[model samples]
Target chain A: MKQIEDANQEALRRMLAADPVLVDVLPAAQVIPELTDRMILHAGPPIDWERMCGPMQGAVMGIAVFEGWAPDLETAANMAAEGAFEFHPNHHFDAVGPMTGMTTLSQPVMIVENRTFGNRAYCTINEGLGKVMRFGGNDDEVLKRLAWLRDVLGPAMGKALGAGDGLPLKSLVARGLSMGDEMHQRNVACSGLTLRGLSPAMAETANDTHDLAEALAFVAGNDQFFLNIAMAMGKAIMDPVRGIEGSSLVTAMSRNGTDFGIRVSGTGDTWFTAPVEMPEGLYFPGFTEKDANPDMGDSTIVETIGLGGFAMGAAPAVAGFVGAGAASGAANFTRTMGEITVGENPEWTIPALDYLGVPTGIDIRLVVETGLAPSINTGIAHKEPGVGQVGAGVVRAPMGCFRQALETFAESVGVS
Target chain B: MSETKVNQFLKTPVKVVNIGLEGFAKELEQQGVTVVQVDWAPPAGGDPKLADLLSKLGT
Candidate 1:
């Protein structure tokens, strides 16, 4: 018994010690290649960000003007068309961007470095879903909002976060599960708790009454803001176990405009992919399947690590957006998901099971046997060429991808 | 029947959830309710919502 416990501890330690990064990450201009408006950086694999359809493209254009790379939308468009600037993906830079998933040179991002493994990951703030830049619309209002986020909100949160002790995202995620937040669609309580945790620091650096009030309201209004913390934490926890010999654990799952890709623990960065499809679920007013974009973005990594839609019981309200009885099904889903995983997340946990750890480290072999793929909550972009976002919903990672991953992993490990 | 009336059929204590899962049906029978789970796949071009749970259990 003691030996088994020790083995678990060692495995966990090794997982925590992998690929961690430590640094303050600013926007793309400060740390990444120049982002042109025409360059569309989709998740999973390399695709042109500019060629992306709908709200996603709009978001990229918005990021360009905010970065001062272009004086106006037309200039941004011209630069992209003429290749005046380079377009790189958020994933390539060890970062994940939200919808339209655009990260530009000047934007500030959360720089969480795993001191143990020395691997780093970055992600920008959530644009609150509706009318946000990542969804692909480049309107005047979207650009203005981007400017405010960079100039005011980003710096304020950075100072508050910097002055305080390193924010322990793992604890917040556990608390979120207890308080009706799946850490995806319904982060109302978690967002409040996060803002409250940083309140003292924010108050000290706020400088004036107006700035403080605005910052509080911004955090208060966005329910899904805690998503980035979940993403970064997931990245941190999973980075350690990558490239483990004979391990069939799935390391990362994400989607580009063209395909869905996943990396396995046994293989180093080899992506198994499948054609993308639209997520099936309830939509907002006047939006139909016709308006929804195919799966896109790295947010699904949150689910792969067992937080987002997987813990639906944590956020019952998501049923309204995804499906009825999602709370019960979500619990069953996560519970079954645990059956398919090698172990539980050490640092992050869900409070529903008297503080049971969130299921972590998806095993491809287990998924093949159980016939259950990971469930993801996602924002739907319009299917049409240039329409923005149509709605949001839940989806399952296709089983074929996992089957292929399992077969390939079995071969590599010399197993029948 | 109206949608509300149709929903009322499910509110009764002796109700059946017809989803082609025999295990669930047998379990329901153990609770003293008459449940006959059957593989009643609805024909094509039908209202899926009405046909899915009702047709399988409807005597």
Candidate 2:
């Protein structure tokens, strides 16, 4: 028992020490080996087209139109029906997306590399809030923004990063936590820091002066622009610790609106799943819980690696943002999560905990024993397609997935 | 000061004895965390009927 526990700690230590950085922006086809023509990568566990929920179906059609595989949504829907494309989960290819978590072949994606481990992960560029394709926006306006990102912003970012790898993401995240950004639902500080890093680079990009300024302003205007980078950074760090035999740490936890799934370190890519639950928290003025879809997206990678919601105590404002009600409630949730994690992250301390390190390293065993679930702050998409974001809130990982993983662990160790 | 806790629990082996909810024990078991749950009930001496019988049979 002691040996197993030690092994788990060792793996977690490596994860904690990993340095993930945003190195470049590139077309998905150039960087992601698995993003082949007619194949779309999505979030959570794999699912077939027939079983897809409304928002996912909508996003697929939107991605198809953006890829020019189909001229319009109508054609895209028909193409999917005729099996003109292949569907797969992003986790299979070391990539993740938020909401419908859509990634198509031609889309531009952020490439984050783990400086310490040399592993990489990818995520689509943030569309900067409302009516974006990630939330199933298929209008001409959404497609136009994607084109601008691909042609102008992406090239400028790549130039800014240069051949010399980008800024160390962990350092930025550490500073962000201290400055009241949790790197999840609230990323005001991290975004500001990122823009500051890229401002000089934007000044040098070859794009027309007006276009370049607009591009810089686009990122500057969108607060969540840094979130996709942060999520990719998380993936780059955590993917390296995957499949460490007998190590019961949770390497990934994600939801597909239809289901919530998790991968355990000891289980080697095996996913334990349960039906996703609706998030509980504040909603947009015109929406309510009933209009909100089940929790979805790969953004939980932030919490999976001990940022975002795990550092909630550091960003009390995020509690009200995600429905935790108040700063004290967020603080309590953060402390509870600590009970189930392996240890505190020395680098990212929460002020509410007397500047205690934010809880890090989720151990499957600890979660099951403590009956505590990791709280994730996430955007809530509407159940219907094309409606875009309805709200943002906090949600607990389903206990059932943990239960199933525990059963598997018990059987594997011959303890049951 | 808080940085020192990066591996607080990992430095020690685990042995958790839960006194109430089995759910907590179940959760721990999944992660391979060591947990021992006590199936607790009220003491028998607290029951008036049982207490009276014990008193009547006392030496």
Candidate 3:
């Protein structure tokens, strides 16, 4: 027990010590060396093309076309079905994504380097809300936006970041939490903060004023713009927590619509999986649960390091949008989550909860013992590809994965 | 006959702290009794194998 506790403490210490900085933005192929021409990186655990959900399939087809591997969605679909492309989880390549989370070679990815751990993580920039590719929109409009991001915004932001050392994310997230962003469904504050931090450099580095304005407007307009950056920061922080011997702390939790998966620090990279759950919450006008898909994304990494759902208390404004009861009741979610975690993150405290640290280090042993699943705040996509976002809400990580991980962890510790 | 302790206690404004199932707590509340429902489930969802493993790990 002491060994496990010590290992978990070490994991927590490493996580708290990590300083993830937004270093640059570059093409996925150029940065992730393993990303070959025909390869595509998606969110959640590993799965092949045949099993990908409607939104994921849609995004893949769209990315295929965007990459010039195919001329149209129909052709892309045919090529995908014919094994003309390879599919891998973004996590496999030190990255994370939201919703369908399709990351391809041509898309520019934001790079976050963990200065303390000396490792890096990557994520594609968030496309503004509505019918976008991450939610499975693959029409000509979606393709055109992807092109602009690749050609214009990505390079501009890259040059801006190049002008400076890089943007430090820890304090920005601390500020966002105070300003009512749990860094999942609500990132308005952090998005604005990100623009404020980068605008000066963007102005200094710009070759075209029109492009700079468009890029600035894009970041300012999208409230969820910081979601991808938070995700990359979460990945960078947690990657260093992996492989701590005898620890029961979760290193990652993710869903791919078909399956929800988790990895424990003790078990290394082995994934424990179960059927993914559907989110329960408010829907946009005219849409209902029937239009919603099972939850999917690598964004749950935020919860792994104790932001997102675990910090819901900090963002009372998001309560109604996510159907999480009254704003005052939001703090109860954080309190309940604390029962299943190893400790609190003192650096990221909630003002509403008397500055209590967000619950950190989800311990599988405690999850199994207490029978409480980790909660996630998420956006709901239409089950059908190309329909895009239908709603937003909260979902629970499956308990089966925790139970499986605990069992394996016990066996590994000679408890059998 | 003298009232028993159970009878005396029952007469003093019934209150309940229910765990594991909400139905019991709901029934009490419906009967005009104060009830605090605690959200809970059987450890490891009552899977014997997992419960056993948890016990082995000193749960």
Q: What is the C-alpha lDDT of each candidate?
A: 0.66, 0.82, 0.91
Off by over 4 Å in 1: A1-25, A29-42, A49-51, A70-85, A324-326, A346-351, A384-387, B1-59
lDDT of 1 at A329: 62
Q: Which parts of model 2 are misplaced by more than 4 Å?
A: B1-59
Tens-place lDDT per residue, model 2, A326-389, is: 6777777778788778788887787667888888789776666555688888988888877888
Q: Which regions of candidate 3 fall more than 4 Å away from where they truly are? A: B1-14
Query: If scored against the real structure, what TM-score would every candidate get?
Result: 0.79, 0.87, 0.96
Best by TM-score: 3
- What digit string (tens of lDDT, one per residue) describes model 3 on residues A290-310? 999999999999999899999
Model 2 has fnat of 0.00
Give per-residue CA lDDT, model 1, range A146-206, as digits (tens): 7777888887888887786656565566677777777766778878887788778888978
Better of 2 and 3 by DockQ: 3
Q: Candidate 3 lDDT, tens digit per residue, B1-59?
A: 35797788867987789987789988888899899987878887788888888777653
